[model samples]
Target: MERPRYESPVERAIREAQERGEFDNLPGAGKPLDLGDTSDPMWWVRRLAEREQLDFTGALPPAVALRKEAATFPESLTALRTEESVRAVLEDYNLRVRRDRLRPPDPRMPQLLAPTVDVENLLARWRELRAAAGPPLAEPSAPEPRRRRRWFRRR
Candidate 1:
C-alpha cells in the first residue's frame, strides 16, 4: 500500500487556484510545447539563448569566435568612417588571433584554429567599398550662431 502524498500550503494554494479556473487562459495555453528535437545535448543552452536574445557566438571557443569575426570582418568594417579606424580594428583582430594561436590548444577543441588575416587585402576591400559607396556626405554647416536679443539697449 502507498501512503498519500501530503501537499504543502503553497501547493494547496496552487491546486485551489487551478480548480477555480484561475490558471486557465494563461499564455501559451493549449499550445504544444516546443521542446525541440532532443538530439543535441546543448539544446537547452540554445533555447535559453534564443529566449534571452543572446549572441550565440559569445559562447563559442576563442578560436571559433575569432574565425567567425574574421568571416564577418569586411561587413563590420563598412561602418567605420576612416581608414585609420579600419586599420586599428584589423590590427586588434590580428593581435587577438596571434594571442589565441600562442595559447596551448584546448584538448577538447584542438582542431579549432584561427589564422591571422591579411591586413592589406582587407584594407583594399575596404577602399573599394568606400569608393563604390561614394564619398561620405558632408556634415551640415553649424547653424548660424543663434543671436541673443538684448533686453535693454547697451547705450
Candidate 2:
C-alpha cells in the first residue's frame, strides 16, 4: 500500500479555507482566460498591467510609444493654459520624433515608425477648442472698502 503523504500547515490552512468556501465566488471565478489572438510572449506582463490598471506604454518601442502619444496629442493640449506652452510642447514632441526617426529601427517592431507631428495643424485645433470653450472668466474686482465705526458722536 502507498504511504499517505503528510500535509503541511500552509496546505492544511488552504484546504480548510477551500472547505469553508473562502476561495469561491471570487473575481473571474469561471471566466475563460482572455489570452489575445496572437501568442505574445509577454502575455503575462500585459495581463498583470490590465489587472492592476497600469499604463503599459513604457514597455513599447520608442517609435510605437511616440505614435500612441501623437494619436492623443490634441486632447493633451486642452490642459495647457497658453499658446506659448502649447507651442513648446509640440516643438518638444517634434524634436523627440525627429530624434527617434534617426535611430535604427527596433528589430522586434520595425514597422512602428512614428512621423513627426504638424505643429501648425495641432495649434489650429487647439485654438478652435479654446475659442469654443469661450473666453476665460474675468476675475472679481477688489471688495468695497469697509465702513469705519464712529466711536464719538459729533456735538
Candidate 3:
C-alpha cells in the first residue's frame, strides 16, 4: 500500500488558501501577493513584499502612524473608555496603511490566481511553475495516433 503523505503546516495553509478565493483577481495568477501587519506595519510590509515572487527592494518609510497607534494602546487598560478610543483610532489607521500598500490591481494581472496558503507552499508553487510545466522527460510516450492503426478504425 502506498503511504499517505502527511501535510506540513505550510502545505496545509496553502491548501486552505486554495479553497478560499484569495487569488480570484490578481496579476501573474497572484504570483505576487501583499499582506501587512497592523501590529508591526513596517516589518510586516517588508515581510509581505519579500514573500512575493518578485522582489520589491527599496527604501521604506517608517510606519509612523501605525507606530503611534500601537503605542497608544496600553498593555493594561486603566480605563475602558480610553482603551476603546485608542482601539478605534488604531483600527482605522491600520486599515488605511493596508490599503495604501496593496494599491490598485493591475489590469494585466490574471482574473483567477492560485490561492496562497502558507509562505512555503506559495514559494514552492512559484518555483515549480518557474521551472517549467508538462510531463517529466523520463516518462515514455504512448504510441502516436498514426502508428496505432488498430482494427477499430474511425469512420
| lDDT winner | 1
lDDT of 2 by residue, 58-99 (tens): 887898889888999787898787889999999999999888
TM-score of 1: 0.74
Say which prediction, candidate 1 or candidate 3, comes out ahead on TM-score. Answer: 1
TM-score of 2: 0.67
Ranked candidates, highest lDDT first: 1, 2, 3
Q: Which is better, 2 or 3, measured by lDDT?
A: 2
What is the RMSD of candidate 1? 5.1
Measured against the true structure, the TM-scores of the candidates, in listed sequence, are 0.74, 0.67, 0.19
In model 3, what lDDT does residue 120 have? 41
Residue 108 displacement (Å), model 2: 4.9
Instruction: Kindly report which residue stretches of model 2 are placed more than 4 angstroms away from their true locations once superposed.
Output: 1-5, 18-46, 107-111, 137-155
Candidate 3 residue 52 Cα shift, in angstroms, is 42
lDDT of 3 by residue, 29-96 (tens): 73655444556748765675666755442332334434443444333222323334545544555566
The lDDT of each candidate is: 0.87, 0.84, 0.48
Model 3 TM-score, all chains together = 0.19
